[model samples]
Target chain A: MIATDPTPADRSLLATLDRVLRGNFTRREALATGRIDLPVGRLIGLCLLLGAIYGICLGSYSAFNGTGHAWLQTLASALKVPLLFVLTLLVSFPSLYVFAALQRLPLDFRNTLKLMLLAVLVDLTVIASLGPVFAFFAASSTSYAFLLLLNVAIFALGGVLGLAVLRRATRDVFTPVPPGKALEPAAPVEPGATPPVLPPALSLPAPSSRTAHQAADQARRLLAAWCVVYGVVGAQMGWLLRPFLGNPGAPFEWFRAREDNFLVAVLRTIGNLFGR
Target chain B: MNFATDENLLRGGADVTPSARACLGVGAAGCALAGLGLGAAAGDVRTALFAAIKVPLLIAFVAGLCLPSFFVVNTVLGLRDDFRAACRGLLAAQATLGIALGAQAPMLVFLGASVLDPYLLTLCDAVQFGAATWAAQRVLARHYAPLLARDARHRHALRGWLVLFAFTGVQVAWVLRPFRGTEGFPVQFLRPEAFEQNAYVVLLDHCLRLLR
Candidate 1:
């Protein structure tokens, strides 16, 4: 399915990324095309670049403050930043595609993957852009608690914005395509009672149609539920892949033993910051 | 362009974008001058020289730290087209800050020389900095007026930038400390434990102390 296109000949990878960053891809007209037309491989590559940028910034705190193996800690962080998001997406994507299909939404497996990657691209872009701010604070401030909280806040902001982009795109997806512009099915039909197995000649019903309305409502509900699930998965993924911001007091290690969860660590950090 | 004669800096114009290089140069020079006045309070030329370098460095660091986040925000809001203008506005504001401070330098130096109590001298210097900051903010608003007219989203972005810049400026300034040299201590570019402390934590500690 992925190899059908020869190459995205017109747009360079950087140009494609620039368009996405400027939100040209998420516009209603663009979304109304009924499939994310982004080059998935390039999107993944861009996501990695953005993630690594932020990761290096994250690691610089350790590099400047740690006792030893500063460069190794930085290298580890650069690798892990992309891994955190990509791993979480890989882990959560199968269920996302299945649930989206079962809900009879417009997305196929490939389209679903594209949308997920697009959402992640948005998240990582925002985080990476704030990399300088993070590095600056890391250099200037000694309070580990403050840096931890700042990182959490940044991630939260990125996540919220990314989810909003996803919501907007998904809303457009639920709308029936304009007359005669019926979206080409990206995948073979699932055999058993799937709406995707459309009667080939029949044009999609108008916006007022009941099935379309029901599908939109279903998509909304699914999106809300999926957001919670994605957040949980992402947080846990980050927790499991610990030591992204290497603790200055500790020697460099690739991963910390999984002891406490993300929530507990955040609360404890807040407490420590406030002299509790 | 010529900031001194540019009416756009006083009354915002969309077309008249200030020269970023010129703004930066003027701002740094003005800030360096202000630093000399500030360090003169220590009654030593050596301290004055240190302050001269650190003041501009502090401003540059704060702005540099905040720029990426600001650029991304503007881009996301579909205001990337006006980014050059927005940046020019921001730079003009920084230059205004420097110009305002520079204008106050002679008075600050006079105040430093005249004041008997070191605490009073510090208080007066703080008040001057606050006043200059207020002036700079006014210039920023003038610069931002055109942008706000173009898109209401610019308002949010402007507010966000201000909060971010101020928060970062405080921390950067704290880390690049001893702008005002302490009595009986050797003059140094930074306090020996400069990076060992965090400004927000110190503020929290002070607030807790007050509560106690």
Candidate 2:
């Protein structure tokens, strides 16, 4: 009976996950008017667990395509993708915070970290959702290159969608309320951003539809920027954890030299086209 | 309501936030020193010295090149407002690459000393450099993300800037070779000044030849 009841933290984590999977966020008004606190640690843990599961699922392709100790190599592939995404996000967080401030998104460091982590979390979930389809294709496709390109395309599609939701959700949820006026205040107006025509009463951080739209608009571009940053960061992480799709002939390798960098890989692909 | 545009796009030395400056500046500088140390661990002391002095120069020069291109691209793209911030942001981000790499310096040196195999050492270098580059890009994107609300095209152009920066950085590295002095070759700062072998083309050839 005691074991049957989930802890309060578990409940919170489950609630956040439910919200995220719903593919929409709390309305800006609701988020601002009502409290938008989240148990960020638990939520992130859920996100990583999901991401690793998906990564492992996707890593099955490496095992399918590679030879000689392919199973062991597949395990490495599984470990690498999650490691790559997670490590890159952690390493680059400070800069992300600085950038957030620069944009006057001005996410408090803690919230900003949570928002970014959540974004990545969302991305991994979306990718994982496609895992079954990808695994199916990997099983059928004999050409390693074809499968690799297809997986990359799928991952990109997932990333685009995940980021869209994150942008909308984080904007509404994380936009700060004025000091001491969480329940009733005017929309957040950056100092000198708006003309001072409104009455003193309007200065409070109240939930206005117009302000909600404005806030969402403000975060749209920043989210767009994050998409690119995450993409590049993810790519670099992937390169380091190479042999994602093993060449059919080569024995399984967990890591490859820098010879497979974007520049080299791209050029080689192009060159093969011209030479053959 | 207009967004906050501080009249001075470029904050001066005095105006620069100490934390931001320290994070970026020390990071970039440390990466340079560590790069040499890592290179030295791979081969000989002279090679290490060459790497130490030059990798930082490579990072700075590449970042310096990015500034003008960023300004020109933004101006051409009708994003004049973002030019100053973009420039400064990149400078800081470039420093971040150094910081990220510098942080890993100890681990890299340990690997270099312990692993005598050149192939393994090369793999280590690749991993560290790749991770560092990713971290730097994350920083740069952070600085520029909010500007995305103003113009979506800027994101496209910013990405272009990244590709340009990366291609140029890699080429510069190739041109100034012997960062890790080949064990058998005489220790020289430069790779004996030969005609630049197109690294990409060479890679392409290797793969194509392997198949044949």
- Each candidate's number of clashing pairs is 0, 12
lDDT scores in order: 0.78, 0.61
lDDT tens readout by residue for model 2, A18-116: 554443223343333332245567756876776666666666765654567767766776777678777888767766666666656534576667666
**Deviation from native of the Cα of residue B158 in model 1, angstroms:** 1.8
**Highest lDDT among the candidates is held by which one?**
1
RMSD to the true structure for each prediction, in A, is: 6.4, 20.4
TM-score top scorer = 1
Worst 10 residues of 1 chain A by lDDT: A195-204
What is the DockQ (computed on Cα atoms) for candidate 2? 0.01
- What i-RMS does every model get? 1.6, 17.4
Candidate 1 ranges beyond 4 A from true positions = A1-10, A102-104, A175-177, A180-205, A209-222, B1-3, B6-8, B11-17, B114-123
- Over B1-212, each residue of candidate 2 has an lDDT whose tens digit, in order, gives 00111111122222342344554457556767676667766557677877888888777766665554354345434467677666666665666677677777788878877887888888888898899888767666666766776688688658857875775566567656767767677877776443234444456568978988
Cα lDDT tens digits, model 1, B159-191, are 878998888888888888888778889989898
**Looking at model 2, what is the TM-score of chain A?**
0.73
Provide DockQ values for all models, in the order shown. 0.56, 0.01
* Per-residue error (Å), model 2, residue A35: 7.9
